[model samples]
Target: MWRELALGLAGPLSPMRQAQPVGFRAGQAVTQREWRAEVAGWAAHFAAQPGADVALYFEDSLRAAAALFGAWHAGKTVWWPGDALPATAERLAAQGTHFAGDWPGGACARVAPQPEPEPEPEWQPLDAQAPALVVFTSGSTGEPVAITKRLHQLFDEVRALETCFGSRLEGARVVGTVSHQHIYGLLFRLLWPLAAGRPLVAERQAYLEDLTRLDARLALVASPAHLKRLDLPDLAGLPVRLAAVFSSGGPLPDDALAPCAEGLGQTPIEVYGSSETGGVAWRQRAPGADAQHPWRALPGVDWRIEDEQLALRSPQLGSLDWFLAADRVRAEGPGFVLLGRADRIVKIEEKRVSLAAIEQALLALGGVQELRLPLLPGRRQELGVVLVPTAEAWEAIETQGRAAWLAPRKRALEPLLEATVRPRRWRLVSELPVNAQGKTTQAALAALFDPMRPSARLLQREAQRACWAIEVEARHPGFDGHFPGHPVLPGVVQLDWAERFGREAFAHLQPAFAGLDQLKFQQVIPPGACVELELQCDEAGCVLRFVLRSARGPHASGKLRFAAAGEGA
Candidate 1:
C-alpha cells in the first residue's frame, strides 16, 4: 500500500480508485466519485461567498466532512462549534460567520445531493499551513474556550493515528455513538477512516445494541461514559469481532475495560487527551491492570515532566515548543501513570484540599455508584456532590428519604475526607448531565443544585416515554401551604408535574392544554418521599398518560389531553 493509503493524511486520502465505495450515507453506499462531486459543488458554492470564516454544523458525518473539506478547498476558514443549538448558531453569527449545514440561524446552506462539477470533478490538495478549524473546549473545567488548528495539525494527527493503530484497523468500517461536531468524534470517526480508506457509517448509533447489530470488520469510536454503562446483554448476538475500538474523552473505567475487550474480542484503545491537546497518548487496559497501566506516546510526540506536570510537544500542537499540561503524572519506564489534575485543588478555612481526593474517597464507598463534585459558589464557597446511587442505596433512598440515603454515606467518608472539604450539599440523581461531546462540564455539574428545576432524575427512556426518579423533600415548595403538618404532594401540583414531564419526555406534545380524563389521586405522597413518575405519550390520540408510584403504593395516575398543533395557546 502507498504511504498515503497506509499512514498519511490530507495529501491524497486513501490511495484508491474514485469509483470505490468510500462510505455509507444513512446505510446507502456512496462512492468516492460521488463524494468528490459533492465536495466540488460545496467548494464552488462556498468559494463564491464573501466571508473567509464560516460556521459549520451538520448531524450527518458525510455532509460534515464534505462541507469541512469543501470549505477548506474554497480557501475558507471553518469555525466548528460543538452543537447546532440556537444559542450556538447565534454566537457564531455574532462573529460574522455565515452558517452552513443544519444550523437554525440565517439561511443555512444544505449540501446539494448529486451535485455536478462545471468541469470534471477532482480532489484538490489542501495547503498544510492553512487555518483549518476552530474548535471549542469540552467545558469540563469551566467555560469552554476556542482553540484553532492549522491544516498541518490535523494532517499530522491523522498520520500519527495511522502510524499508531493502522495495522489493526486496516479496511474496517467506522461507526460511532459520538457526534462528529466534537473534535474526538471528528478525528476518530471521519478523518482517521478517510486516511485509511475505511468505510464510515454515517448515522450515530443510539442504543448499545445498535452498534452490535452491524456486520463484520468494524471499528467503533466511542466515549468512556457510553461504554461504562454497557450491559453485557447488549453485546449478545454480535456476529463477528470488531477490528478495533477507540475511546476518547478519558480512560475507560476499570470495570468497563474487561467486558469490552472480552466481549468485543479486542482491547479498546483509550486515547488520553483533550480537545486542546489533540491526540497525545493512548493505552489499552490489560488483564488485572490498574493505575499501573501507563499511557504511551504517539509517533512524533515527545513528552517530559516539568515541575511534576506532564509536558508534551506533538505535531498536533503545530509547535515544537513543549506545552505544559495541568495533569500530574508519575513516570513509568517510558510512559506515565496519571495521578490527577493539579488544578482540582481547593482551599477551605486556611486548609488546602484535593477535590479529586475527595471524589476518590466517595467513589470507594459501596453505596455510591457514580458522583461529581461541583463547587457551589456563595459568600463562602463550598463543595456539593451530585450522586447517582447504587441500586440498593437508591431503594433505601426511595423508601426512607434522600437525607437517610446520604447520612450513612457521608459518615462513611468521615475517615477518608476532611470535615472542612466534605460535600456540603448532596443531590441524588440517576445520571450525570453530558454535553454534545459526551463530557460533563462544570456548568452541568453545578446545575444539579438549582432549586427551580425538578428534583427528579430521568432513569430510563424509550421512544415516546420516559421514567423519572422524583424525590420530594420536606422543604419542597409544593408542600408549603398544603395543610402544614400533614404536608403531601398536591393533586394540582401532580397535574402540573405530569404536564411538565410529559412535554419533556414526548417531543410531539402540543403547546396547548385541552383537558384530562381518568385522573385519580389514589394515595397521599407525604413529604421526604421518593417516587417514580412514568410518562407515556399516546401520539395517535394526543393524550399523555402518567403514573406516579413507589414501594408504598400508587400515588397518582392520569391521562392528559392536549390540543393539536395551532389549536390553542
Candidate 2:
C-alpha cells in the first residue's frame, strides 16, 4: 500500500479520479469522483474570470479544499486569511480581491461547490511550479507578511507526511479540530488525506462532545490549543477510538499527550513546522518520555543548528537553500531536542508576533518609558503589556483619566503593528518585575496581569455561576460614559462586565455574543458602591444571565445570549 501510494504521489495529478471517500456530509458520502466533478465545475466558472485574485474563506473543510483546487486550476491566485473577520476581509478587499465562501463584506463574488450534471471532465495535471496560494502571517518582525506558495511546495510536504505515517494511518478517516484555512490543517486535514486516498469528516468537530458521535477508524488532526484542554476522563466515553492523532501549530505539552495515549491507545504524532518551512521534523513520545526527547527529522528534510537556531533545507521551501527557523535545538540520539526560542517572537492565536518589535514601538512612544509584553496564559490569544509609564503620562492619567490617556498610545501603534498582534490590555505600573539578576522575567510580568490581584475578586463560585464582589473605584474610567453629575454604571459596561466574568468563571463558555434579551436597568450603580455581580450560564439555551445588586437593590439585570465562536455577532 505504501509503495503504491508513493508512486501515486509522484504521478500526474488526476482531479476526477476516484480511490476513496473524500468526505461525509449530511449522511451522504462525498466520493473523490463526485468531489472532482464539483472542482471541475467550479474551475470552469473560475477559468472565465481569468487572472483574478480570489480570497477564499469556508467553514466547511471539503468545500474549502474544492475551492482551493478549483481556483488553482482556473489559474487564479488564492488569498487565505486566517479568519473571515470583517476587518481582515476589508483590508484584503482594498487590494482588489474577490471574496468566496460565506464572508459577508463587500460586493465581491462568492463561489460554491455545485457539481453540475455535465460530462465529467478528464483529469488534467496541474503545473507544479504555478503560484497557487498566498497565506498571510502576523509579521515576525513588524507588519503582516505574505508567503506565496506553488503547488509543488505544498505537495512536497504532503508527500513527506504520507511517506512518514501513511502505513499507520491506513484506512483511517480524517477528523480535525483545527480550521482548514491555516497551513497545518490545510496539509494534514485536507491535502494529505485527499492525496493519500483517505475519507474525511466534512465539518470541523468544534466540541469534544461531537467526537463521541464519530464511528471507528478515525485519525484526529488537532492543534495544541484544542488538545491542551482535553481531560483523560472526558474522552473515556468516546464512541470510536482514534487510530492515529496529529498535532501542530505549537508545542503540545506532555500533559496533553498523556490523555491521547490513554484514550486513543496511541501517542500523538506531533509535527513541527511552519507555513514557510513545512514539516521539518516530527516526534511521537514513547511512554515515560521526558522533555528532553528529541524530534526526528522528516524524510527529505536536512536540518542543522545555525547559531543555536534550527535551520532546515528541504523541497518544502520550494528551493534547496536552507531556511532558518525561530526555534533553537540541540542534537540528541539521532534526532534533536528543542530548546527555548532563540528569537523574541511568539505565536498568539497561531499568528506570529514579534515581542521585541512591539516593545521597541512602545518605547518609541512619548508616554511609554519601559514595558514588558507577555503572552497571556491559556488559549486567550492576547498579549498583556505591563508598563512603567513616563512621568508625563502618569500625570496625564491622574488629570485626564485612564480612558483618555490610554487611547492615543494604542492609536499610535496602529501604523507599526497589525491588530492581531496588538496588545489588547494595558497595565500601568511604577516599576518592572525583575529577578535577582535584574532581568525582567516572563513569570514576574505575567503575575501582574492576574485578575485576582486586580479590582475583581471572586466571592462565591459554582459550576455555571460566580458572584464577584466589586468596589468600583470613583476614579475608574468606566464611569465616564454615564452622567457626570450623577455617575452611574452604563448598561453597556454592565453587559461587558457580565460577559467578562462569565468567561473567567466558566472557562468553556463561547465568548461570542448571540443576542441580548429582557435587559432592565432599574437602579443606578454609583461609583464607590460595593456591588455583588452574579453571573448564571444557561448552557442549554446558550445564554448568560447576569444581575448587579447592592443594598440599594437591583441595579441591573439582563440575559446575554452567546453562540459558538465564529457563528457571527
> Tens digit of lDDT per residue, candidate 2, span 482-520?
786989777777787887667656656765778889999
On a 0 to 1 TM-score scale, where does candidate 1 land against the true structure? 0.62
lDDT of 1 by residue, 143-198 (tens): 34678998778878988998898998866889998888878889988887887778
What TM-score against the true fold does each predicted structure earn? 0.62, 0.71
Q: The CA-based lDDT of model 2 is what?
A: 0.75
Off by over 4 Å in 2: 1-20, 50-52, 109-116, 237-240, 349-351, 356-366, 376-382, 390-392, 403-425, 431-439, 450-569
Superposed by TM-score, candidate 2 places the C-alpha of residue 522 at a distance from the truth, in angstroms, of 38
Q: Give candidate 1's whole-model lDDT.
A: 0.75
Model 1, runs deviating above 4 Å: 1-16, 122-124, 138-143, 237-239, 344-569
**In model 1, how large is the Cα lDDT of residue 479?**
79
**Candidate 2 TM-score versus the reference:** 0.71
